[model samples]
Target: MSDPVLVIGAGVAGMTAAVELADNGVQVVLVDRKSTIGGNALNLYKAFPTDDCFYCFEGNRWRPGIRKCFYRSAMIDQPNIELMTNTIIQDISGTPSKFTVKLVIGPQYVDPKKCIMCGLCVEVSEAFALESPQCQPQAVTYDPSKLDEGAKKAEQDCPTKAISLDANPSEKTITVSDIVLATGYHEMQPVAVDEYGYGVLQNVITQLELARILDPNGPLGGRLVRPSDGREAKRIMMIQCVGSRDENYYPFCSKICCVFALKHANIIANERADGRVSVVYMDIRTYDRHERYYREAREAGVEFVRGRISRVVSTEDDTLEITVYDSLLDKYLRFSIDLLVLSSALEPPEGLDEIIKTLGLKTASGYVGPADAASEDEVVVGEHVYACGGVLGPAEIPESVNQARAVVSKILQGRK
Candidate 1:
């Protein structure tokens, strides 16, 4: 019997679709290039609109019977689902009902069957520890090039000898009835936007990097300190649409940058209470029920500057000096800030061009658009292939999950 469905890119969107299908007695093959499932989500500290915690977790880590995070464990526990990590989809052939996919599966470093979650290896060599939260299989791969005396000691200390120095990658094929392409997105490089002085200014960082700074498990331990110096950011300036909504670079609106900057401003207000946070944007784009966030942000003393930044220059003191053309005031204003955060644009995930060309899908603004968005109002790219999340276009967490479920509904309805 052939597998019921193949879900590519195991992010939240793909995970939701896989779980829904498997729960309804459909066999699913979830594949991703990363060792972990959560995509851009891992880089985020809090989501927009409600600003809820990004990764929902409960119970103690040491407890044996404690309930684990649903997103982290559900797919692994589901008997009908096969979680394949470190996989590369080389080819996709055939059509609607019987799709043949060629895959190159790479080793996970350690043998999952023999290894227990003992911290022996991690303690021996800190390099063995993976940075990702809720990593599936929970084993670190051994790299011969990076190995040292500590890694050798850990290998000898392993009771099960699950650490393998030589593991060969292999090729395989899986046939599935349906294919859902939920490949998320990649942050457009900020260096492309010249005016923002991304590469020129030392204190400048992207919005995604700001999210990492806010994350408790991030490099700074969630302290929100300036990269140039270990000082708390007292005067922070967030410039929106650095690479987005620009004629020179990406001309499309990145939908989420406006509100994403707003959320960060709110966090700074709450954290410091007196932290001077200013957002420089062409215009705010909080629509529908999320308007409350805008109101709350204003109430919390987050300054919204209506303008476009002309240039950012680095000072001799290692600070950033921003020159903005304020639309509201009809004048240029110069300000010095400790940190300059760029709200960069979101682009399609890497290698999506090959998949798009191979599948013969339509593109909108360099993104995978629906085959018939006007009539179908769906992300259906081809007969049996569908696209969602950031792959379809730049989408937030809520929109991506919603679109994923909608695609599954259409898939299941067709089966009926």
Candidate 2:
């Protein structure tokens, strides 16, 4: 029997690849360890270059013809794609064309297949409802322990009898023609850059954390406040390349950090208006079309300084003192700030070792790559495995999408 192609890590890259293949008459099984589909992109408020909102509509109400990213349940409605969230790849065996992939799938207390999503479970018991009411793969979740009274009530209340505390996790084996690994990158390791006062300082946060704070639906409700004092961050200092480009961590430049820093500066400029945003970087990398965002940031009065932070210390007055050597000025500059955001490195995701061991794949700087990249995109890694997106390296949304499509194209061509 012909099995669906398996795409691991249901990030933008994986989801795009799965959709492309499935739309082109190929069955696909998209899996991610996270309960929701969107990966790092979900945390983002806007994308660079255009500074467009990632998912929700931020357009003018009078204007028509607007489009947004897939932050909702549209993917769950696709007939050709099977989305398995909260699932992990346990082991792999057999050839790529006829591979048996072992998966450890977590139990969805309410089976989406049987769930009508009438909210009766939520009415009966709010015990295990997902954080967001707008969560994807709509199903009422329940906890066995909390459901002592609520479980039986929800079970009876549910229109489709989808609520069940007896749903136990089980190992599932799937046979697939190919495996597409799109495991995305992780945030900068703050513990490595201790001098930056990341975990040490309350207001100091990684760029990813800033993205979460900037997100309208995030914990802070898109409010720009210092994590330490809960006061509006009127003054912010952004330190670039926390882990990336540093010899101790990832030496290579993480291409996305510069633009992201600028994006944050722009946000503070627009939102706080009187906000003082200072960006200190060894070198400003606004390559190609992204230069506009850099110019916009500068025009918005966001101060750009050429320097690397030497140390970040706390002050007696509940403020952060960031010390950086300005190579351009040939002097050290100190910035007293309410919040300091570090644009850290994009390291490889977790479970990379497991992927390499189980699949016999090659890795470069923690990214999944062929034994030789020059071989071509379509070449099977070990026997029938493929990798794309940030798994191969630091890639932004556009590049990841292109890479995903490229992988699908190669797979389709090989099928014929």
Candidate 3:
């Protein structure tokens, strides 16, 4: 068979490249190990303050539309783009100009085309006591752990028999002219740090966990509560840069965390009349366009403390005692709060090293493949192999999409 232009990852960058290449008159095959295309951003409950109330809605802010996600739906539906999900590239060989790809595609019992978004599968699974809160209702694969209590009952309850605990597919090999790798960054597990007592402290939560709590469709139904006690929290303290900008940890500042903390604080204060929230940070990097967001947050009465937190220890009353050296006041201070939120640093996602090795791609920082010789800091996209989005480096949605477009130009130009 003739070689098609291959794009690895179904994230915004990969999908965008696929559509752009197809539009430019190239046969393309977009491959992803995941069943869905949205990537890490899709796991997000809402787009900060823009998506109505993150804590109040499961469906999109405006209902069924591709714009609901950061990557629009139309990008995937493009005629020239062929999306292959639940598939991983097992091997790649030949020069960058032309290559062979061996892929392993797993089975998804529920065919996306055949299943309407009616959510009957969820209802049936729940009736059989095999429902998982962590599982997305729209997700193609069902978690077997959810069926542990009554696997027999759940099996009978499945009207479509679409729940597959074990679904394997035959491996196949194909050829491609070029490849684009765009696997994105991963969320750091706050529990790994250990200083904040993440796993031990029930009321202590990570920023992502806070997002889940604020999500109306989440396990907490949007009420900010103490995880251990299930009581609505009146006072919340968000600790910024928990794993970021430290000599011991990641020395660089995670750019978006400050704004995220400010946004979260503003949202919580606005929702609850008596809500008191404070953000503890060494420096606030509202450096450019984000300065306005910081200004608005201050105007909304959210407290920003310029201090470095020393420790977070639980008190006898189950409240968290936060110790910080307030640089502004030149004094040490302590605050007790019902909830302690850790603005954990983001890291590159798992399986990237293996993927890099499999594809013979270079890497740095123990996560993603390294950048080009011209630009040592940025991930280098070879003439025939391209990379875009967070896999290249940390960036917001706009920057991510822009990188994708740049890759498209590179690929098209190479073709000529």
Candidate 4:
């Protein structure tokens, strides 16, 4: 049997490469450290360009546009691709044409294919037996924890006999030729900055949390309200460049932040009829393909203040008082707001340094150094390794998918 190419990270670049290689009659093994595929992009509440719409957009908004899946389960459903979720490549080494990989596969009690998406397991277990408080709603997520009293009951309740409480598998290793690393980037925890008070202040939310609330399909269903008071917000302020462009935090500009802030402002306007939101930024870096999106946001009446926010304090009324220096006006202004959103910066994904170390890769200035001879537009590093999305650096959906297809073509050509 021919050796299969091992694509790590299961992100946009890796998925695209695997699909293209498999379509070319190359055996493909796709693995991700995460339990599911989507990488960071999947965890996101909504995608850009179309906002709440997930499926309508296809392809790169630029170039010969094509649709690419950024979500995990969606990628696994693709034909000609073998997705090994909850799998990690512990080590990788080989020749240019062939390689060897050691993979650790975590057990899945319930096969995702057999999952009927029925609520029966959760429904029955709750009444008949104590179940995991964190029992996932999806049928695909059968708890692997050792069987307790509650788990035993839930197992019997599975009409499909799909539940397996004691399904942990011992580690096994597999060898494959070639490797692609596409583990995505991580968001800098805004709380690291003492002043932002992310965890300490309930009303002071990270950008991602705000995204969830703004997302129509998110936890709040596009409703903009104070998590603290559950009341309609009268005034909201967004603190931009938090953990970004500062020597103390991150010394680089997180490319997508400006548009994301704009998107948040748009969400605020769309959700609150009487609320006013202001974004405080050093300068809006709506670069590359995000220009149009920035313009669209301005037309929607989102206020953008070019300034540097200095401090934030809770007022007597529980409102947040933000002090900023407006560059245009050359004046300092203090505003009281009901909610404060911090547009935090991007960091290397969780455990990225470890993964890079395992793969003998390097990162500089908080970015994984691209493969030798790699260009700004290319995501493929070697014969089988590819990276897309923010893993390559701060990129929007369009750039990520664009690099994904480019890497896909390179993988396909190599298979020939």
Candidate 5:
């Protein structure tokens, strides 16, 4: 048998590629640095276009048109695919198809197979907590730093004997026939952008943080409340292009921010009771089929301000007073809101630079670039090396999945 294909970053894109390749009888090693696999998609409350569950993926060929929950997919039981969580690439050597990759695998404090989602550990120890209700592995995660007597007692009393406080990190070297980089993007935290008062202000947050707040399974239990005083955030304001399309930060446009911001706005206006949303954007770029989001948001009574925020002040009553210069209306506008969300730029994940250098791959605006600029297959980054999803740049889930399929096609075609 040929060496298993190594797919890095077990986000939606990497998972899709790995699952597809495995279904086609190819062996795959799917690795993720996170304790679970979903990545940013796990936090996103709803996917645009379909507005369906973010975990919903195209089911197997036998069940076409059926959307299957990724958490319950073949990833866990698939014979051809090996799932590795809490793993990172330590080093890359050799070349192309014959590459030898060294991986440092973090210790698994809780055994997923034995875990029954009983929440026994969570109740006993602050150190042990479930990441999400839909988290893959369906187990509680443990933090060594938070270890206490309660943690020790919980480990001892674990019904399934899944808790292992003595677990240690391990390293392994493996050779692969092909390498696929799906190492996703990171949501920029606009702490440096003082004008928005992101870091210093309690109610100011990034889009992803707002996503968590809106998530039914999140800490706040889907209640849109102020972080300062835990009151309902009836009035919410979103600022677009927080760190994108600017000379000081990323110059390239983060293509999906506008659509998702509008997605949030529509949800607020239509779903939440007495909720009002106002968006401030230089330009609303909901390209292609996603234009409907902007339309729907407007139709749902969501306010749109074609301008930039000039000032943000935290009032004594824990509300935010914002000033905007409306370029379209040629006037300054002022408003007070309960929540201020910044649609910050999405950038390539950290540690991608080392991987790029190791693989001798090209880059575009800090994202993985096509090896041959003139080539039709943009996913191919180098000899026997390819990229998909957010690794190439900021992409929606569907686009990322399509790119994954393209990479899978290329690999399959090359083998024949």
Candidate 6:
């Protein structure tokens, strides 16, 4: 049998590539650093352009339905795929088609196979909690730092004997026929840009945080409330280009920020009661079919200000007073808002540099770049080594899926 193909990251792109390859009679080893597989998409409530659930996707030809969700997909049950969560690449060696990888797998406190999703463990201890209702492998996770008597009791009483407090991390070395880097992007926190008052201000949050706040399964249960105080955030302000398109940080356009900001704005203006949304941006780049989002947002009475935020001050009443220099109007404006959301830059995931260095891969603005810079195919980063999704740059779900398909095609064609 041919060696298994190693697909790293386990985000939408990685999962897509792995499932496609597995269905095509190829062995796949899917690995992710997180305890669950969804990555950033897990937190996203709705995808732009389509406005469907982030997990909703067109399943493979073998699936009964045309559409399926990540949580309910064959990711965990597929026989051709070996799923590894809480694992990271420690080292990479050998040639492209025959690379040896050392992986450090984190300790598994709760065994997913034995776990029955019973609430007993979670009810008994603060340390035991479900990562998400839709989390794949469907199990409650345990936090070692919060170990207490309650945790001990829950472990002892667990119906499936899934809890293992003394579990230790182990390492494994594997050889693969091909490597696909699907390590997704991370949202910049914008804490260093103190002018935006991100970390210092309680009500100021990033787009991802806002996404979570709007999620029905989130901590607030879809309530758009101020983080500082539990009051409803009726008047919300979003500042775009928090870290991108600026020489001080990442100079490239994130490509999707403007559309997603408009998405949130439309949601708030149309769905939420008495909610008002305004966006402050240097430029609104809604390329391709996403221009509809901008139009819809405007139709919903969402205000668009072409300007930059000059100052942000927090009031004692948990309101944020923002001073904006409207470049288009050539005047300064001040407004008090319930929330200040930052459309922060999408950056390469942490430890990506180490992976790039280990694999001797090329990079563009810290993201994995194509092997042949002059080539039109961006997925192929090296011989038998490819990349897709946010690892290549800031990419939307459709684009990421397409790239993953491209990688799959390349691999299959090579074998043929």
Would you list the clashing residue pairs of candidate 4?
A: 38-72, 59-66, 59-67, 60-66, 180-385
Clashes of each: 0, 0, 6, 5, 0, 0
**Comparing 3 and 4 on TM-score, the stronger one:** 4
- In order of appearance, the predictions have TM-scores of 0.91, 0.88, 0.84, 0.85, 0.97, 0.97
After TM-score superposition, what is the CA distance of residue 372 in candidate 6 from its true location, in Å? 0.7
lDDT of 2: 0.79
Error of 3 at 191 (Å): 2.5
Estimate, for each residue in 1-416, the C-alpha lDDT of model 3 and write its tens digit.
34678888776577667767777788888887876666665545655434443223233234334343323343455667777877887888877777878888876645555433445555556422211232222334555446554444444555566555455586888778888777877667677778788889999888778877876666667888888888889899888888787656666676777777776787788877678898888888866777776887788787888887778888887888888788999889888889988988777667777767766667655445544656743434554777787776555555666777787787777677
Worst 10 residues of 1 by lDDT: 57-66
lDDT of 5 by residue, 107-211 (tens): 989999999889988998999989877688678888899999999899899999999998999999999999999999999988888999998999999888988
Model 4: residue 185 alpha-carbon error in angstroms: 1.2
lDDT of 4 at 415: 57
Rank ordering of all candidates by TM-score, starting from the highest: 6, 5, 1, 2, 4, 3
**Per-residue alpha-carbon lDDT of model 1 for 195-215, expressed as tens digits?**
777877768989989899887
When superposed on Cα atoms, how far off is each prediction in RMSD?
3.3, 4.0, 4.4, 4.5, 1.5, 1.4
Cα miss at 190, model 2 (Å)?
0.7
Scored against the true structure, residue 108 in model 3 reaches a CA lDDT of: 62
lDDT for model 6, please: 0.89
Model 4 scores what on Cα lDDT? 0.67
Q: Evaluate all candidate structures by whole-model CA lDDT and list the values in order.
A: 0.80, 0.79, 0.69, 0.67, 0.90, 0.89
Between candidates 1 and 6, the lDDT winner: 6
Candidate 1 off by > 4 Å: 57-68, 112-119, 123-126, 141-147
Task: Flag the better candidate by lDDT, 3 or 6.
Answer: 6
lDDT for 286 in candidate 2 is 80
